[model samples]
Target: MLSFRMLAPALIALALCGTGPASAQSFTDTQRGDIEVIVRNYLIAHPEVLEEAMNELSKRQAAAEAAKHEAAITQNADTIFNSPRGVTLGNKDGDVTFVEFFDYNCGYCKRAMTDMLDLMKSDPKLKVVLKEFPVLSQGSIEAAQVAVAARMQDASGKKYLDFHQKLLGGRGQADKARALAAAKDAGFDMARIEKDMASPEAKATIEENFKLAESMGMNGTPSYVIGKQVVVGAIGLDGLKEKISAARCGKATC
Candidate 1:
């Protein structure tokens, strides 16, 4: 448990050296030691400077990370937003597109599914894309394969959404067997779904999803893309609405 007071000296040392002590050739050991003492004394006298320095450092780091995310989004825009592999929901020809990368075994994703559905129901002009990001377990991967296979059997994706709701909203771990049962409940032909599950198309779609997720630095489920902004976590329905509004009208809400 390092406190701000304890960390101030190290931060000050970095500020003076402009790099780690090992890489710093400009200052001698004696000079560096003297500078550290001076910085420590000064910071002790004026603690606000330490706070200001920390704030600036945080701002710069956030700006750099945001730039990286924006660049990644630009590079993968086509595959991310318009890929045929992604499951399409809501208005197919909507003005604003929202994308979600989710795992069936994710508890947060199950809770967030309602937010997605509610958004679809409330906003007719919003396009929703569901990416199968099954990093939780083998069962998650199996469920995603079946979901993608269900998508293939019926291109309309009507049954796919139903199957999604059934499995994600169901109790306990969602495995291949449970996923197949959901598909059956959604009126999908079990024989065809089983065959399609083992097809290369299903494998390819999941592979592409993993690739896209990796490219975008997504390491978890329930992450979202609303226009150019990459939003992580469930973030609730209000948070989603604000992002959607921001995308459409340049404001948090219309």
Candidate 2:
């Protein structure tokens, strides 16, 4: 916020004054007046720069504060999700639960899928709750509808996770047609899946997910609520493992 450009004149003035310490008795009235005039003119000419510098400083401070708040939010994920929609994975009676809010078109979500799969495979005491919070694009919404329909046909837990990973891991956009195709590839009956996707129950589930996401203040895809922590983005497998360990110990790692 302290503008180096605006400080150039002051620096030059200081350099010209030499390394000697200023003595009250050494300066003439005229010299004092000249210095004051220079400073006053410089400030007056750059009045707008002062405001700009202050605003920039304030923004940096605010961003730092927000980052701190986000870290704390990650540490306190217990109060984040009381109830969530979509299929769940891991032990039916696992000790720790990792809840995720994801969109089908989210690249980060796709990246996180590998970590989730690894966790499930390596840890038997871990549980995962997948919440469909498709807020990216219309294609994402259609994908969510198809995912909900898959859940209706008993495609919960691993199957749903599998389908989600497949759609996001690929290069194509996930629209209704593409989602249906993916559902079939994941072993779901395409016609039944499409019909179920349009049901009132599925619509209600998606609506609930939207409301929950809004209430939780989640703005983007691939946000997670693990134990008492909320992690946004794919923070990698080690990060997730640390959080899971903390959760097991009745604490949370941000």
Report the number of the highest-lDDT candidate.
1
> Model 1, residue 214: displacement in angstroms?
0.5
- What residue runs in model 2 are displaced by over 4 Å at the alpha carbon? 2-84, 250-254
Give each model's whole-structure lDDT. 0.89, 0.75
Error of 1 at 49 (Å): 1.8
Error of 2 at 139 (Å): 0.4
lDDT of 1 by residue, 1-254 (tens): 33655875666556666576566666777976777677778777997886787789899998887788789889999999999999898899999999999999999999899999999999999999999999999999999999988888877888889899999999999999999999999999888888998999999999999898888788897999888888888899999999999989989988
User: Could you say which candidate leads in TM-score?
Assistant: 1
For candidate 2, write residues 1-254 as lDDT tens digits. Answer: 45545665664466347645556346677876676677667767878856885788799997775576456555444433334345778875788888788888888888888888899999898878788888989999999999998887774456766677778787877888888877877888788887888899888888877765665567887887666555667889998899898879855442
For every model shown, what is its TM-score relative to the native structure? 0.89, 0.67
**Model 1, C-alpha of 78: deviation from truth (Å):** 1.0
Deviation from native of the Cα of residue 166 in model 2, angstroms: 2.3
